[model samples]
Target: MSYTYDYPRPAVSADVVVFDSSTDSILLIQRKKDPFAGSWALPGGFMEMDEAADATAIRELKEETGLVVAQVEQIGAYSAVDRDPRGRVVTVAFMAEASTSESIAAADDAADAKWFPVDDLPELAFDHSQIISDCFSKSDKG
Candidate 1:
């Protein structure tokens, strides 16, 4: 079977803001590819055809940082037309808090993965700066 649409379809992606409560740090990955290569960003990527947005978030987090968080809550969705330089991409953001004792290693499309204090972060890629701000604000209240 084949299906096609006359108009363009925006791609869907999932991003996760992982906060280490023990150290008050957030996980960030250095992008290994273009569109923002070498820039720090949240651990996330495009959803797979067979997975839900939430599942994508979890999977991306594990793939990029090797950190397995038990629970992740949806924060919000970002749909800025120019959010992604690759094309029109709509991202669903998820937030989670974990312990800094958990182990992590960079993999997949991430050149490097590390934790940064919420008060101090490197220049971020995409609209991650805004996403982190929003996620942090929500976490602060909870």
Candidate 2:
């Protein structure tokens, strides 16, 4: 079965905020493409048709940062009118914890990958700063 929409729909994506509690740092990637190219961002991408948001988050984390996350929890959803330069994109953000020993490399749309202290991070792309703040809020409550 197939259906088509006459009106435009917001594209959905998932972002992962991988935090290393031991180092008090978070993994961020420098984007290789435009729409904030060269800027730091949480690892993520658009969701595939056969994938759920959680799976997208996990897959993107691995694809962009070469880091395998054991588990991810939904932190929040962000859908601002002009958040994405490409289109109206709504993103579901996920949070995970990793050890300081975990290895990471840049891949896919990532130009570079590294860990930044949570308190001292570079300017982030998209609405990632807000997403990270939301993730921190969620963690404080749990």
Candidate 3:
């Protein structure tokens, strides 16, 4: 018998869940770019060549949210049909626990950024809501 592995080629991206302990809010941004314009989403972007996934996530958090990650860990991977508006995309979600959430803002492709309470979240673009759900579920496990 011959064995083969169909290599999966999906665009890799990272999502940063910046949490604000002061207000108990999570960071979200209004995407200025396509795939989901004028909609709320976590601070994230695609990975560059030779970039590590966790590093990319942190980098994205800094680039998009002006917030440095004090601690970060891999949450999970999300890949589903039509997950992205552009094309098939696979995202490696990473949750960042920042020491201080204050003084954080948005830039780059984010039109506007702000923090919202977890209980009062806005309609999110893509399957980010599900990703957040998964993150909380994982947290509940431990």
**Leading candidate by TM-score:** 2
**lDDT over C-alpha atoms for residue 38 of model 1:** 90
For candidate 3, the TM-score is 0.87
lDDT top scorer: 2
Question: Cα-based RMSD of the predictions, in order?
Answer: 1.6, 1.5, 4.0
Q: Give the TM-score of candidate 2.
A: 0.95
Deviation in Å, model 1, residue 34 alpha carbon: 0.6
Model 1's alpha-carbon lDDT is 0.91
lDDT of 3 at 121: 95
Q: Candidate 1's error at 23, in angstroms?
A: 1.4
In order of appearance, the predictions have TM-scores of: 0.93, 0.95, 0.87
At residue 112, candidate 1 shows an lDDT of: 95
Task: Tell me the spans in candidate 3 whose CA falls farther than 4 Å from its real position.
Answer: 1-8, 99-101, 140-142
What is the per-residue lDDT of model 3 for residues 70-135, given as tens digits with 9 covering 90 to 100?
A: 667888999897899888788998786654435767788888888888889999999999888887
State the displacement of the C-alpha of residue 39, model 1, in Å, after optimal TM-score superposition. 0.6
